[model samples]
Target chain A: MVTNEQRLACAYLLKVGEPPAPALRSFVSEHGVVAAAEAVRSGEVPDSVATETSARRHIDTAAEDLAAAKSVGARLVTPEDEDWPAWPLLPLTNAAARGLKWASPPLGLWVRGSASLEESLQRAVSVVGARAATSYGEHVAAEMGYGLASRGMTVVSGAAYGIDGAAHKGALNANGRTAAVLACGIDRAYPAGHSTLIDRIAAQGLVLTEYPPGTPPARHRFLVRNRIIAALGAGTVVVEAGQRSGARNTAASAAALGRVLMVVPGPVTSAMSMGCHDLLREGLATSVSSVAEIIESVGLFGEDLVTKPDSAARPTDGLDSEALRVHEALEPRVAHAAERIAEASGVPLSRVRALLPALELTGLAERCESGWRRAKEPV
Target chain B: MVTNEQRLACAYLLKVGEPPAPALRSFVSEHGVVAAAEAVRSGEVPDSVATETSARRHIDTAAEDLAAAKSVGARLVTPEDEDWPAWPLLPLTNAAARGLKWASPPLGLWVRGSASLEESLQRAVSVVGARAATSYGEHVAAEMGYGLASRGMTVVSGAAYGIDGAAHKGALNANGRTAAVLACGIDRAYPAGHSTLIDRIAAQGLVLTEYPPGTPPARHRFLVRNRIIAALGAGTVVVEAGQRSGARNTAASAAALGRVLMVVPGPVTSAMSMGCHDLLREGLATSVSSVAEIIESVGLFGEDLVTKPDSAARPTDGLDSEALRVHEALEPRVAHAAERIAEASGVPLSRVRALLPALELTGLAERCESGWRRAKEPV
Candidate 1:
């Protein structure tokens, strides 16, 4: 069990510094959570850490914030916890270490479900798209979510309107695990219309966010929140995104974090799919039309290889060019002499003589009273 | 001018050998057409050449064939003719020279239209697809055909129904040049239902084939004829196709001939687009969503580059992450002091004080009685 002291310190740090706070996170890693929290509160931290915490460090709402979270059945999941999802967020940590400031890992996640965040994320895919998505896009996104969740993978998404809501509902309908990474506080529903949907997600799977209690959802928070959604999933599927949507931002983050980025192709005439086509045209993402393709893309090497779709068989599928020519030369009702057939097919008389018997045996041609004719069906 | 003897020799050669007749084509290219024809007629040729011509070599119907063509207003265009599309057919000749037996150039072309074959094919794109195309496929094909033709490029297609017919009609409606390559005699319309459409194309553009007069269109001939469609254009666009459609055969032939292979994207739910999707997944063809993209794929270097699609602009498009957070922290109607805004936004008090004035200058925030509030719009 996590100590109450550590939990309180994490809660204090989480409330004081807005994530992703690279300077404060590193400070806590070096000086432990409790020491860092105390220093931040006393205004005794370094300039870098002070810059991130100075505005709210004096509030000292750790105990009240913890009570507020508990009132809503949420708890702080920190790195000290067993379900921190270290593996999935490693890419973000590494990217931040490489000086991508915006890719810093979140300080802690406030989760409102009983499922283990680490376990739920082990096989997860993020399904994201525009809030103004078309019906076609919504249908595809929901199908993708249901398919992925039914196969024992978690479907992660933002709990907003349009494609995200559709995906979450599809996952919930499958009785499968899903996690909504939100831009607002754990107790608040940003879109208001999706409050019931968000509540259902919290009861059935997980509703997670980095924001402290009572924080309202803001525009900039959505953009910042997208990185968490991208980090928590093994791969990201962009179903339908406009050229300038939040989903594109998540797609960029997924790519930067070295995750598999898959795009579903839609009709070229749709404005909603333009971003996806642009990514495909630029070779930045793979085109995945079916769930099998998605599995094959993100599954372990050679584990989920997709079987080629069956093509309709044709009667003359394996016929050589010359044999095909002879077959074409045969009339369905009229019998032509071997010499006439040879002349029409432009095959040598000897070759035609040899091929006719072979064709007759294969039931592609029939030896009529006069000479030969095409068989209407194989016998 | 092509001499009478050369035209007759080409006519006889076209009738005697079924293309692609590699040995006979090289023979005519080495010895003159007249000499090759005389040798084949007299049975005094090499075994390889004799193998290709032996069936019909003795039946010299050159004069009769010429008369039959004249009755239909068609004439034989030999390699010796001024209008032969030598430049456009160079790839086939080179492939045949490299010992690809299936890629031999045609002996001669039987032309039914007045346009110069070489001139009409100088800037061309072959638009091909399945005879069982969906309406969506037909619409895209027609749009591509009309768009390319309207830009002064010739549209080439087989005169079959569905996508091919739509493409040809689109080009014709634009009052632009187009060419219909046939599997049978130029005088014979293979898909009889399209006789009127074929006649319109011949009247407005060109109807040309490599087969002699009175020859019927056969299954093997359609496959054989596809090479010419792939060769006549600088690139080939597959609008829509089933897995086993002839359009895919043309796409493969275009790839083999080193022509640009482009595919139009359609809905994944549509079976008609599966072949195009497979090509895209396999990276065997480029995805072209617009006519401009098609031109960019085939046009001379940077000459027909496409402009990037414009995205809708947002007011906060240029704001830095911190500035955006500050903007998000300010409520539209409620004013709060700078200290409260700093705490809400988690920005340091000093930084918040500096950024608020900057936000005010940009009209993103306004000074209220208490402190500041978000401006409804930029002033």
Candidate 2:
């Protein structure tokens, strides 16, 4: 079933060193791998091209690797494949062109999921932030991941710790789809600690990478990996980051790509949230606190997302009449506790306890450690 | 020496509730007091047509207040006076027009200080914040006030508690000028505790108000007072403020008037600093930390304000070769102790100790509690 010419072209491009892969990708995208091979074979392409010497030698080595790739059941994806993500359709896609110089053009992405890359691309929102995210940041990211995924969007992020892990778990707990894009090969999970999360993502959604099946994650690869996470989503939301955070780099790439960039503002004194504040001040992103705000920014929500059969499970619709009565009892600028709401709603304490859950579930109210107050959009 | 016509115009406008006085100002500017009187007497001016019984009663009552004002040395500053503050030249001056309804325009401002009102206007910078300002806020405000005043700019602020008192004191300690724009009569200082600071500013710079002498500060009057503070300066800097603070109101006025609004950022966790962060995120103001940044924002420099005679006494320009050697020995991006500077300079510790003052005086370096840093600019 394999074409010799395609196999040889793949082999030759993969053998190139360091920058060889990206340059070869550029050559392949502009001219098919067969044409690039002929140019290399005829010595028409420059041999001393910057950082291309390794790429030239990789041709023979790739042939051997291609055999190895086959044995592992991994298939290379080309730009011409039906499964290729159509991100280039976005006007800002040209901004990601900078990623081409560091690594091979992913030799086509290695993907493992039943979901088509095209479909996932159309429905993905990237949720990213610090590996050491605070409990507050974790709560927000989880809520956002669940809220977005419940609306039928695929959550995308690097399979790392903190906010990323929380986002994946939130989606999984909600029985929603989420993809984990890795810096290493599909078979390799960096950090070793997140093996279970990566496995769950592979089982439920997808675990994807540009690297060969066994290639380990490198320091430089993480930076390159961020671009893929950004490109896979229609928008990127940073939950928490510090002044010089890696999340800012992902935001920069998203901004350059002209994707909708959103951020959740945290307490201003937190060093962990300063990057979000900086980005908000720079006008590169909009501040959002709720899933509704994110959905609005991407223009992805309407009757289609909100009016499905699953709408009955939506938090916005789960309120009981008693809860509604209690909410109506409180004035707009006034905060009330559960006791006050119970009294105002003419419900007994026992009944109020039962009603409070319905109010929270309906998103009509929220309970702080102090007491219950009318639920406001996330801030 | 007061003219009857001038007295009458003030009384009538005060009686009529100071209806958007710009047109009246234009009339007064084009014609002398006698001419304005002739127009009013002839019934040519719409404002003079007090046909209703209530309007006529108000005019009579205002005449009594006007008589009382003269006895107390309260003189109105008409818009036409050469001594009038040139606040109208600012971009947001029109936004402050509504504030005119709260008080009568002075025929000419009453004064008690050596500095001319016009000169004060040209150099004014308002420092405002919460009445319950934290020690950190007070410290920052004091530093800003002293620094700006020492550079020959007049500091302006409401004569209230916490930050305001510190700002005025900082200016006074530097033997520099400042203005305390009171919501009440200039004759009485509100917050009784700040009487000493208010008295000092009155003697050294000015204690000004649109309210006639003897009128007590009212809650409503204080709200309107912020506009005058904002209008009188090239910029307004909020040192620290809570979520619903009056300092935020002053910053809003400055922003509406198109004046440079600057805020000092605090630790993101401080509830007191959240207002500043909110303003910064909304692109409503710039964040400033040091006196130099404030001076830069308003286009004032120490060189521009320092007189030749005063420059001689200034600590800058006194650095000896030994001090310069110590400064030069410090590495960029590295914190160097005084001992380290001495070691690196190959100088006796005693000499380095003596030269440290000269180095700081010359602004080539700064001494932090931990160590010294290369001054980004001459301090």
Which candidate wins on lDDT? 1
Superposed on the true interface residues, model 1 gives a C-alpha RMSD in angstroms of 1.5
Can you write out model 1's per-residue Cα lDDT over B208-302, one digit (the tens) per residue? Answer: 89999888998888888999999998999999988778999999999999999988877778888888987888888888889898899997447
lDDT of 2 by residue, B211-298 (tens): 5555566544566678777777788999888877789988987777677898876654456776776677567887665666677776
Q: Kindly report which residue pairs in candidate 1 clash with one another.
A: none
| DockQ of predicted candidate 2 | 0.03
Isolated chain B TM-score per model: 0.96, 0.67
After superposition, candidate 1 runs with Cα above 4 Å error: none
Model 1: per-residue Cα lDDT over A1-379, one tens digit each = 6788889899888888988799998899899888888899999989999989999998877788888999999989989999999998999899999988788898888999999889999999999998999998899888888998998989999998888998998899889889999998998987999999998999999999989998888887888899988888888999899877899999999999998898888888898988888788878888888888888888733677888777766677778888888998999999999999999999999999999999998888999889999998753
Candidate 1 CAPRI assessment class: medium
List DockQ, one per candidate, in order: 0.73, 0.03
Model 1 preserves the real interface contacts to a fraction of 0.80
lDDT of 2 at A192: 95
Index of the highest-DockQ prediction: 1
lDDT of 1 at B184: 94
